[model samples]
Each structure stands twice: as structure tokens, then as C-alpha cells.
Target: MIVASVPRTWFEEAVVVFFDVVRGTRAEAGQVLLPDGRALPGVRLVEGEHLAPGAVYEAEDEDGRRQDPERLRIVERRAGSDPAVRLEHVLGDEGTVTVVEGALQGIERPVAAQLRGSVRGLGRWGSLRRVHGEARVGLRAWWEAAAGRHVSGTPFEARLEHRLAEATVWAVPRPHGAGRWKVRLELSLRGRSFLRPVAAVALLLFRNRLREAFTDRVDRLAQVWNEIVLDTVSQDKSRLRERILDAAASPPEEPLL
Candidate 1:
């Protein structure tokens, strides 16, 4: 299981609006476009019932070997206070995962939200064990000494754990004026057992490639989010943003693994 929080900025708009728009849309599976222009197919939301506790939805995905169906149940909803919702993913006899989202305390300008996720029956090394992970995202204010102004953005953290290994990823985006942002990302992995030795060897061999792949994924995700916001909310289109959207919709050069 892995939990991750992603903070995003969309054209000086409220974060809540972004959240609402995504929640209201019917999510398509296997359609997510990767930075490398590859498409992952076999997952889609077949059903959804508003956004409240007890509401159940159906999803289907191709798990490489066959079609796998799953159910998503709303575990909690708090519309009156922090305006948050919790969802649980049930994978029949396989396992389950839960995700929680809500507003962060004490900050409001950027309309920050916290994300938490956990999973069960997910482990490597074929032990039929369990794994867990969690992530958090919140808004923070910082003073730009050069610009002499205060700005805000989201900081993200994620940690995943299994009996044989663990991984952590963190990202922080800094504003560079004129709606441009630079993100700093860090990833660390540790492991034990025979798997650890193999992973260490792989890391030593493909360290640069792995880092490049991770960076590319992050960059693409940010681009996709920006593209979605621009398509759904804004009419004005800059040349750079338009190019990004076009690339996002382009076909991959090779098949996804």
C-alpha cells in the first residue's frame, strides 16, 4: 500500500473547484496518459452515486492476465464541517485499500486538502502478506526574499512499507512568478531479504535511468493536471499550455509495459 498527497496549482483558482470538478467527472481507467506518451488501459469507473458515505461504485481493470472487477465504497463523508470524503477500494478476494481527503487545518487561502491512503493484502516477494502506505498534502506560506512577497503552494509527502522494502517520496513546488512553478522531488528506497540485494543491484545498474523515469512521471502528472484545469475551466490558452495538452493526447511511440 502507498499513500501520497499531491498539491497542484491551477491558474490562480480555488483548489476546491478543482477537486469538485474531478470528483464530478466519470473517471476512465487505463486511459491515463503517461509522460512517455504511453497509455495504461483497463480501469474505469463503471458506476458512481453522488459523493457520500455508503455510496457504492463499480470498476473494472485488466490486471495483465485477465479482467478484474472491483467495488468502491464510500466510507465517510463530512460535508458540513471540513467537507471531506473517504473511499475504500474492495478487490473481492484479493484485498482492500482506503483513501481519505479533507481540508487542512489553519490555512485557507490556497484551499489546501490532506490526502491519506492505506492498503491491505499488498506485498512483494510472494508471501501473501500485507503492506501499508500513507501520504499528506497541505498548504504553506513562504516569503520570497527576492520578490519581497508572500506566496503559497502545496507540499506533498508519501511513504510506503512492506516486509521486504520501503519507499518514500516528497515534493515541494516553488512559485517562480508569472504562474510558473518549479518542483523539487526526492525519492528514497530501502529493502531487506534477498529482494533487497536484487533491488540494490538493479539500482546500482539503473540508478540514472530510474531517476529519469521518476522525474518524467512527475513532470507528466503536473502537465496532465494543468491540462485538465485548462480544458475544464479556462478559455484562454497559451502556446506552451496548448502544446502540453496536445502532447498529453498524443499516441504513445511504443506500447506500455
Candidate 2:
């Protein structure tokens, strides 16, 4: 997600933190070296028309190593507008994995989990004080067995939308046969208001600190979600699953935002 309100100083610090989290090291010529020794290419813009829908493109690692080709399909495209792209990966003898952008908005499944919280704080500057706001999380998950009985009892397609005081999150899970699932998650942070006098002064005098405060709070919420939900699903440990189930069943009484 793009955050236009963040100051350059905070943005730079965030970039460092983000790369560190991904175990990436900066390389020459704007490249990044991954933990596995693969180089991540810098961002480059491409003409939308040149990327024809339903076309297959060769996949290559950062080091230009050949891998399986990926199929590309344009899900939605409009002139003078952003296009939604769909990518599919075919695993020979396994299953076909598909990811579609702008697909979550169409999900109609009922919510299977939820949480709520609120947070408020006074910043170093009085004008940078945060207003108390509520956070709501809704999750819908499904599990499908590879061969035997289906576990989790959730629908094959799941959608989650978490509305935080400062941000919103949407996630969708898609199943690729062979017990594999792919999830697409999007996070959007609310833009800051600069029209107010106090806010304007804060933006001019303590923009970096404000940005840092916003990012740090959002990061904490994200970390909690990862630990309580995503991590459990990834490891697939039965004991952890119980904890997730409990959390889902029992909503927090205190504000967590």
C-alpha cells in the first residue's frame, strides 16, 4: 500500500526495517539480495497492452535462473485506469495455483472469525495526540483435505476484512489442490488530514515522528495477527490450531487497536 503522508525520513527507516524483516540486503544498482542468495530486481514499469491476457511468460529467479513458466491473465483492464492481473502457476503432476487481483470483493462467504480493539495515545507533541478509535477484524477460513475428510469445516473460499482505527485489511484464500492454499491480503492505511491547524503544524514540524508513530502502531497490530493466526495456519500444528479456534470464538473485551 502507498502512504503519501509518510515523511522521507520515516519512509527510509521503514524501508530499512522492511528489508531487514525479509532478510534482504541492499545490493549495487538498486537490487536486493535475498536470504537464499537470489537477487530481487528493482521495480520497472511495463506497458499494459504489451502484457496480453492469457499469455504465459517464462519465470526466472533474481539470478536469472530458469524456473517454471507462469501464466498471466488480465482480470480487469480499462483505458486510463489501473489493470487487475491474474497469475497462475502450474505445478506439473501436482495442481494449478491461481491468484486473481480484485477477486476478493466478490466473495460472499460468511465471516468465521472476528476481533475488536481500540487504541489511543498522546505523542511527544501535544498536537500529535491520537484519537481513540475502534478496530474490527473478521476472518473466514476453510480447509479442504487432499483425499480424505475435509477439515476446518469452513467453505473452500474464505474472505476476511479487518477494519482498524487507522487501516483496513482485506484477505481472500484460494485453494490449489494437494492441500495447498494461497491467500491474498491487502492493507490500506487511512490518509492523514492536513487541513486542521494542529495537524498542519505537526506535519510541518514533526512529520517524521508522526509517520513513525503511525507505522509503529500499525505494525504492532499486524504482528499480533501474524502470531495468532497466520503463523498457526502455516505450521499446521494441532495445538496451535486450538489456540486460533479459541481466539476466534472468544473476542477480546479490551480494545486492541
Candidate 3:
């Protein structure tokens, strides 16, 4: 069994999300939703349940290997400008991640975000979250997941172990310059039982390798974001929508060591 508190006492792995904003700004969020706050033209909302203030949107795109819910959805019919939009990111085969609060604003600039989701494939893991993005302050999250048992699928299917005792990811940002941020991402993971000492040593030994992998992935994501924002200045909703869709369809390349 893995103890929740004092993960430092058990096996732990850490990674950081550090990157520089070269060609983006708080205003770029308008590319998704107009600066005045309206869904781009011809943009359609992903099917989801409607709540009082806002409606939930999920990536129901069923094409290719639709494993993760990294699908695209338009922000439509919300309240005033900068209206809150709920993002439902599909996770694994049967998991949906929802940014229920203080996150729609995050789409444009880093702000306090609360992203929550549940996963149930190899096992039942509820409340997997990445819930904060305050610039000056750091992010904190609590996690508890179940162990996977008898997970069956194709040879490529993963029989993931339900061994993650607890995990937390933090994003800390500082102003680099005009419209630029120096953001650092941190990830901490703890394993349970006999996997503690063994896994910890192995992960710590290759710690730098993990950092490199994280950095490369961040670079790719930043690149995609820049591509959307830096496109030719135009109110063409179709062009903007296409750019957004293209980015989501072609995810960043695999992390290269």
C-alpha cells in the first residue's frame, strides 16, 4: 500500500514544465473566441450537457486513434465577453477531463485554473486533476487512484498499474517581458509498496533525461500555439477555425531524447 502523506518518504519522480513565450500574448485567446467574446464564425460547439451559466463541451471527435480527448470545440453562446467555457478533455479510453472553473480565462492567459477528470480503463481512477495556474503563486493538487486488474486488450493496449499513490503538478510563471512569461512546470509522483525504492532509484538516476523530454514536449506545444496566434491578422473565422483544428489534429511530435 502507498501512503498518501510524506511521499518524499516513498518512491518519487519529478518533472518541470519550463518554457518561454516568444510569440504569444493575452489577446491571442481571441483566436478561439473573439476579443469581444463570441465563437468564431461557422464554429460549432462540441456536444455536452448544459448547466445554468455555461454548458459543458467534450471532444467527441471519433477519428484515427482517438485515445485522449484532445479534440476541438468552439466556444459559443456564452455570457458576456471572456465568458467562462467548460472544456471536457477525453482521457484514455473511458475518461473525461473537465475544466469546471476558472479555466476558460486560462485559454488566453495563465490564471487560476481548476481542471478535474475521471479515468476508468485498467481500473477506476477518479479525480485526476491539474487545478491551478496562478502566476505568482504555485499550483497544488491532491490525487488518489485505484489499481488496475485484469486489463485486457490488443497487444498494444496498456495494462496500466494502479500504483500511483499520489501525484501533483504545479505551474509557476513570472513575467519575462512585454507579453512574455517564464513558466516552470513541476510534476511529482509517488509509487506504492515494493515499487517505491526500486522505481524511485531508477527514475532519479535518469532524472535529467526526463527533464529533457518534458522540455522538448513543451517546446513543441508552444510552437503550435504560436502558429495559431501569429497567423495573418484577419477576422476570417473560417481561417481561424481551420488553424485551431489543424493544431489539434496534428499533435506535437513525440518527445525525442
Q: Evaluate all candidate structures by whole-model CA lDDT and list the values in order.
A: 0.53, 0.36, 0.35
Highest lDDT scorer: 1
RMSD in order of candidates? 9.6, 23.6, 16.3
Q: Count the backbone clashes (under 3 Å) in each candidate.
A: 4, 4, 3
TM-score of 2: 0.25
Cα-based TM-score, every candidate? 0.55, 0.25, 0.38
**RMSD from true fold, candidate 3:** 16.3
Q: What is the per-residue lDDT of model 2 for residues 69-162, given as tens digits with 9 covering 90 to 100?
A: 3323343433212222344333322323334343221122323322222222223432333232222222323322222233453333323322
Residue 158 CA displacement from its true place in model 3, Å: 23
Best by TM-score: 1
The residue pairs that clash in candidate 3, if any, are 17-185, 69-90, 147-162
lDDT of 3 at 166: 45
Q: Over the stretch 1-257, how does candidate 3's per-residue lDDT look in tens digits? A: 11112221111211101111101111222222332343333222344433223332333222322234443332333433234444433344554543322222232232232333333332254533323222222122211111212222211111223344444445434444443344445666556567778768867898899778877887887676555434422335435444444433343354100
The residue-level lDDT of candidate 1 at 173 comes to 56
